[model samples]
Every structure is written in structure tokens, then in C-alpha cells.
Target: MVVFFFVVGLEVRQEFAHGALRDSSRARLAAIAGVAGVAVPALVYVLVVGASGGEGLRGWGAVVGTDTAFMLGALAIVGPRLSGQLRVFLLTLTVVDDFLAVSIIGVFYSDEIRPVPLLVALGCLVALWLVGRSRQWSAAPYVGIVIVLWLATLSSGIHASLTGMIAGLLIPAYPTQRHKVVAARQLFRDFWQSPSASSARAVGRGLSKGVSVNERLHEYLRLPTALLVVPIFALANAGVDLGGGVVADSLGSPVTWGLIAGLVLGKLLGIGIATLLAVRMGAGRLPEGVGMGSVFGGAALSGIGFTVSLLVISLAFDSSSDLGRQATLGVLVAMVLATVLGWSIFKVAARRWGEETADLPMTLDSPVDPEVDHIRGPEDARLTLVEFVDFECEYCAHATGSWEDLHGRFGDDLRYVVRHLPHHPHGPLAARAAEAAAKQGMFWPWLDFVFTRQHALEREDLIGYAAELGLDVEAFIEDLDSDEVAARVQRDIASAEASGAKMTPTFFVDGCRMVGSYDARPLTEMLESSRRGGRTQAAKA
Candidate 1:
């Protein structure tokens, strides 16, 4: 449970950093809906269980959230194709839901607090925060601190569940810096030339440092927790003997019925109505390719909670008690009921409203426009290659040579388009500079120059480049900081996110994305093959 919760924390933090939480409107929408989702269900749980005046009211936390892994897995297993945007929207929602769920457990379900050990744990978390902020690459101090922290938390009368989550939350998560990747590439080149053990070790260290600790831990821990820890824990703890009269008793018990109603009905109505109200009230809009029917179906799906629900059950009541046994039966029944309800809702919505789309959307959302977009070749070129790039991305810099090679091979036949997806810290600054240069008819030249000198992308350095290129430095600086330039760059960034181009250097050839290597040879071969198949920009247009 600790490991699983730790992975959950990592996922929520990732979403907060890069996914839904990054956008203000989306965050607002998610916040409103998340609060409603939890609040409405809690109300229902309290009402149902409270009226009976039973101890079952203690388990209200169980109804407030959907198990993210279970929910996402079920969504994938079921239909709803081309749901990339929906997935992002739901991921953000779950981040809020799960964060609330964790807080509830920590505050409501904990044992008596031990201030001494709790303070010690708090100090350890502060140390972890400092380590995370210091940007240390070595994992030794982190591992040591976390081990001590976990032990302290266990001794602090806090539930063992929160230690991992708190630790995961304290770890900083962010996009990979381009300079680190560039440095790693240099190390790899060195190892390629002089294949020594020392060189190999250097390459390994570089690669490790190129990625954030949060990502590394998530990549390593997610599978182990999912495949091993969760299954083992569920089997050992989640088992309830339904063969006896327990099912009948649960059916009659307010405890069982309260949980059932709260999850199945409350989650559905809460999320669905809250989402509709929020959108209608102009709080936020739904993700693209998602409609109300799909939202309703997904809301129904959210009721199938598992991990946290089970954890809450254990914390709220003893398994040996009648209330606990009844609650377990309710949860098991709710999973089946929610799944069936969600599946039925999806089928009905698909057939009645025609809102079904079960595959990922294949085409880019934003099409290339020659008038506004940078274009190197003729407008009537036979082939079109559109790339979304982060200016400070190392891979984008590495891929700059491919354009020349491709153009040299098929100069008149290909027109290349560049769009911004400035996901790094300095990417927006760099993109604005590029646009500033573009206003002076030097977009391509600036691209080439900056790709070579990626290390020097400060505002002053960009102005220096404009002067070196014999442009009006004053005008370039003015335009570089202009709102219009910022808006223009933001459009490309938004387009990149919506277009399903996840990485920098993503290439779309003749309106189709290239899935494999973006190297010159691979792209040339792809282009040649497309031509043989009678596919081209003009042909498609």
C-alpha cells in the first residue's frame, strides 16, 4: 500500500507539473468538479449512513475518489477511442481526487499523534525538500533520508500509508533540461570513440542525470507496484467471504447501502452535473473530442474505486466487525455495479448520441498555414513536413541537420513547417526570439544559428545574434518582448498540445505523423515510400 501510494503521489505530481494542472482554466475546471465529486458523495454517504446512526458513517472517505490505475485501465480496456484529450482531462481530475483522498486518510484515519516522532518526520520532509530543491543528482542522500523518514512516520502514530506519499510529494518534478541531454549526447559520443569502462560509466551517469528523479523513480517503481505489490496486497487483504449470509446482511445494512449509493450514484451525478455546470457557467470547457455523453459515461466509470476504498475500509473498521464485513461486500458489489453502469452508459451514449470514438485521433488538430507559418520551400511543393519543436530541446538541436539533408535530396519537392512547443523553462523565451527574428525575414537563419549556439539563448545573447546578422537590434529586442510575439508563440504551444505531438521534433509528413526515427535516412525513406504510394501534400490537398 505504501509503495502503491508513493507511485500515486508521483503520478499526481506529474499531472500537476506537466498535464492538466499546468493550465489555469483546466485547473479551475478540475478543481470545481473535483470538489463537487468529493463533496456530493460525502454528503450522500453522511446522509445515508448518518440516518441509521451506525458506525458506518466513519467510512465517508471511501466514496470520494476513483482509483486512478483501475479507472484508466478500465477505460482503455473498454471502448472510447481517440480519447487522448479525455485521458488528459481525466488524469487531471484524478490528481485532485486522489490528493483529497490522501489528505482525508492522513487527517481522519490516523492513530493518536506522537508529536516527537511527527516533528522528526516533518524535519526529514524538510530535509527532503531541501535536497530536491538543491537539484542533487546522487540518490544516496535521498535513499538514506527517506528510509529514516519512513521509520519515523511509522513511530509517529501516523498511518504507514502517508509516509511514501508525503515523501513522493516532497520530490520535485520537472521537464528535462536541454543542456543535460546535450551533455549526455557528448558523453555518448566520447564512449563511442573510446569504449572504455570509465567512458561507459560516464555515459551512464550523464543519461541518469538527464532525467528528473521523480520520473526515474516512477519509471522504475510503477511496474513493480502494479504487477507485484498491488496484486499481493489485494489478495491478502481484500478477500471477504461472500458465500455466507454476509451478502444478505450487507444488503440490509445501512453501512453497505450508504457506500454503494455514495460511490455509484454520487460519483456519477456529482461529476457529470458539476462538469456540465462548470462548462455552462464558463468556468472551463471540456477536452476536445469529448462531449457531454462521454463525460457522463466517464463519471459513471469513476465510481469503481478500489485501492483507496479498501484502505479506508481497513482504517475505518476492523475486518472482524460486522460493519467492516458489510462494507467490504458493498465495495465489491459497487465495483461490478459501477463497471456495468459505465459500460451501459457508454454503449447507450454511443448509439443514441453518436459520441463514441474508440481509437486515438490520427491527424494533427492544427493544419499548417503558409501565410502565417515559416516556410522555406515553394508553397506548391509536393511534400510537406510539419515539426513541433522546443527551441531549447537537445533533440531538436540534434535534428537541425536533418532538414538540410532532406532539402538537399528533395529541394523543390518538400516544404518544411516549424511550430513551437516550448515546454522547457527557457523555451518560450527562445521561441519569442525566433519570432522576433521572423518579423525581420530571418526565421530560418535564426533557427540555424540558435541550434548551433543553444547554450547562449539569453535575451542579450539573442539581441547580439540580431546585431551579428545585421538586423535592427532595437526593433528585434522590442518585438522579442512584445505581447503579439508571446501570443503567437503561445498559439503554437497550444496547438502542439492539442495536436497530439507529445515530444519535440515530432514530424508530420504529408499530414501523417512519422512514428519511427526522425533521422535524414529514415525520413527520406519514408518520404520516398509515401511518394511511391502516391501520397503528397498536393495530392492530399
Candidate 2:
């Protein structure tokens, strides 16, 4: 729990400081998607169990989560042929999803507790905060403190593992000024040097700095709480003894069926329906080189329930050994089904679609043409505004809001574009989902949806949103498998880098770079200046 919570804190900090949570809309969508995923699944589980007069209905909460490492690892094995955008999309989706899952456990799964232990826990939290703020102690002391907190939470009826997250949040990932200075110097040197030499130097320096800064910070920030701790918990708690009497009981349990059905069926239905509605309403469009087959293939893949679901199961039936096992079974079944179904769909689509034509000769190293107006003012009012953003990048999402506000204020004056810059291993799939939304002309709507629910962006929830958007379910699935869109997304990422866009929400104001979110006052000022310049040129002509 201590490790996990620390990771969570780190991830959260990263999100706020550098990741997708910075984009208000992205964050909001994640939160919403997370909630929808969790709520719908839990509801389904409860309804099924309740209708069947099953006593294990309470275990419905356990069947949530995306199992980031497993899912991403599988996708990774598929190689860059899969859309990088999709990977980022999945990451943001799951982060929000995990956040929501943990919140649910904290709120709904906690036991009747005494105030004394709770106060002690609070004290521990304060101490952890002090450690983070002060950067006084080495990694060992923080680790020890986290263990103590984990015990307290466990004894207090709160999940003990949650302490891992708490402790993680408290510990500093980049605890000292020296670390930051060194990192900055290294980054500067790398920028001026060859990639190979820079990378080698970075590796050596990073190690010698000691303290496992990223890992400790991840633990301090509770990112590991979600990624590592949650996964471990899932594996431990989810491995139900199938021979137990609970297996028989689960056969008749509505919660079990509901969780299974929700994850396997409902996710597809919700995402599919929402996608269709979005397309029909003309809010988004399919990726330029994608079709219905890909959508469905991706949606099916979205059902792989691992981490959050297991956590929910643990929480909902913390005491009911029988019910917990049943929930675990349901999760296991759903996960397998989702994975197989999704993979099968992807394979078939890839076969049918064959390889996408790489006719657009573009790569990350391409230069931006000054004459092209790629950002702001739609060529046609109905044109979309496509963006390639990084989730672990605050600036990317922050820029997203500016575009969104512009669209809202201008109405038909603009549309949206989307791409992905995972920046780190954990951000790709969520970004893909956003781009995938483009396939059905519901990209903006879906983006809005997920951003509003940023806090809940879970893996299952992302799939659920895809289904809810009712994209050409099959095409959406295929798109996830299709390398064409991913390549396009990659091209954009490269373009952004070439253009020197280093933050979230980097804007191309009619193809010229516009950095950061600006209020109307500054925006108008710049606009007027540009207008004046245009007039002066015309007059001279």
C-alpha cells in the first residue's frame, strides 16, 4: 500500500506538472470515463446479483482496472505497427480509472474505524508531506515510514496497501535540488549532443545519483500504488481457489454474472452506442485511413479487466471470502474474453485491411512549412482541429483547453485535431482513444467526455467510452490495430518536436506556433498586431 500510494502521488504530480491531467478537458474526460466504467460495471454486477437473490452482490466493485503493464506489454509486443496514439489514450484512460477505483475503495470499501488510528494515519501523512517538502531524509527512512503507515491503515480497516500510495506521495521522487540540477544539465547536454552518447551518459548519471529517484518518487507520489501495488494486489487477491465452495455459489451469483457481462458486453455496448451517436451528430469523424473494423477490434480489446476490478473485489468483499472468489472468477473470465475478442478482432481487421498504404511520406524529422495554416480557423467551419498531445505533459492538455474554448466561443469557426505523445511508457493508449474518437467524428465530444472524467480514466472505462461513443465499433477496433493512424500521430509528434513545442497544449495559430494558454486580452492583442501587419503589407502592395 505504501509503495502504491507513493507511486500514485508521483503520477498525480507528474500529471499535474507534466501529464494529461493538465488539460482540463482531458482530465475531465478521464474522470467521467473512469466513473462511467466503474459505475456501469458495478451497477451491472449489483443488478445481476440482486435479481438472482445472491448474497455476493457487494463484490461488484472489484471488477474494474486496466492492468496497465500487461495490456501495454501485450500492445508493445505488437510493435509500433499499433497506433502510439492508442497507447497514450489507454494510459490516460487507465490512470483516471485507477484514481477512481482507489477513491471508491477509500470511500465505499473502508471498515467502521476508530478515530485514534485514523488520526495516527493523518499524522503519518503529515510526516510524509514534511519529508517530501524538506527532502531531509534518504530513501530508506521514507520506506520505513510508509511500512508503518501501511500497518496502521490495515489495522484501521482501511486497506493496508493504500498506505503504499500514501507513503509514496510523501516521499520525494526528485527529492533534492542536486538531482534536479543534474537532470537539467544532462537534458541540456543531451540536446546539444548525439542521441547515442547522450543516452549512454544519462543512463550512467541517473544510476549513480542513487536513491532510485524515479521509483522512489513514483512511490512517494503513489503512482506505484496504482501501477505496481494494484497489480500485485490484483494477482494476489484475484487468484481465487476455484475448488472452493464459493465457486458453486458464484454460479448462481448475480454479481458475478453482472460483472462479467458488464465488462465483456456492457463496455462494448456503451462505447459503441456513444460513438455512433457522436458520428451521427457530426461531432467527430473516423481517422483518415481507418474503418469500422478497427473500431470494434479496439473496443473488444478495451474489456481486459485486471487491476481495478480486483481491487474492487477485495474492497467489496474484504471479509466475504466466498464472494471475493466469485468476483475474481468473473473478472478473470471477463479479462480473458475481452483480450481474446479484442485480439481476434484486431487480427481479422489487420488481415482484411492488409497493411495501410504509407503514401504520406512523413516522419518525426519533417520540417514545418511556414505557409501552412494547420492550427486555428477551419478551412471549412466543419473542419476538425487535430492535435497530438502528451498526457504526462501539463502543457499539452493546457493547450487543449484553449482550443476547446476557441471552438466554444467561435462555434463553427473551428474544429479539432488529435495526436499522441506518450512521452513516457504509461501515456500512449489514452492518447490513442482520443484519436480513435476522431474516426467517428465524435473525437471532440469523446475527448470532452473523458477530460471531464479525467480522475477516473481507467482501462475498462476508456473502452466503455469508446463503446458509448458508438464509433463504427469494428472500424474503431481496426483503427487501434492499424499502423496508419499511429504513424500519422507519430508524424505529428515529430512535427511538434521539430517546431520546438515542449509543453502540453502547444498551439499553431494558423500554422505559426502559439505557446501556452492565453486569456482573451493577450490573444486579442496578438491578433490585432497580426491584423495590423497584414494591413501594412497590403497597403504597401
Each candidate: what lDDT? 0.81, 0.57
Query: Where does candidate 2 have its weakest 10-residue lDDT segment?
Result: 355-364
Tens digits of lDDT, candidate 2, 137-249: 35656666666777777778776545554454455553234344447556657755766776776755554354434454454444545456666776577667767577787
User: For candidate 1, lDDT tens digit of each residue in 345-400?
Assistant: 87887899987863234466678888788887999988888888877777762345
Model 2 TM-score is: 0.54
Q: Per-prediction RMSD in angstroms?
A: 5.2, 19.1
CA error at residue 409 for candidate 1, angstroms: 11
Task: Give the best candidate by TM-score.
Answer: 1
TM-scores for all candidates? 0.80, 0.54
| Candidate 1: Cα lDDT at 266 | 92
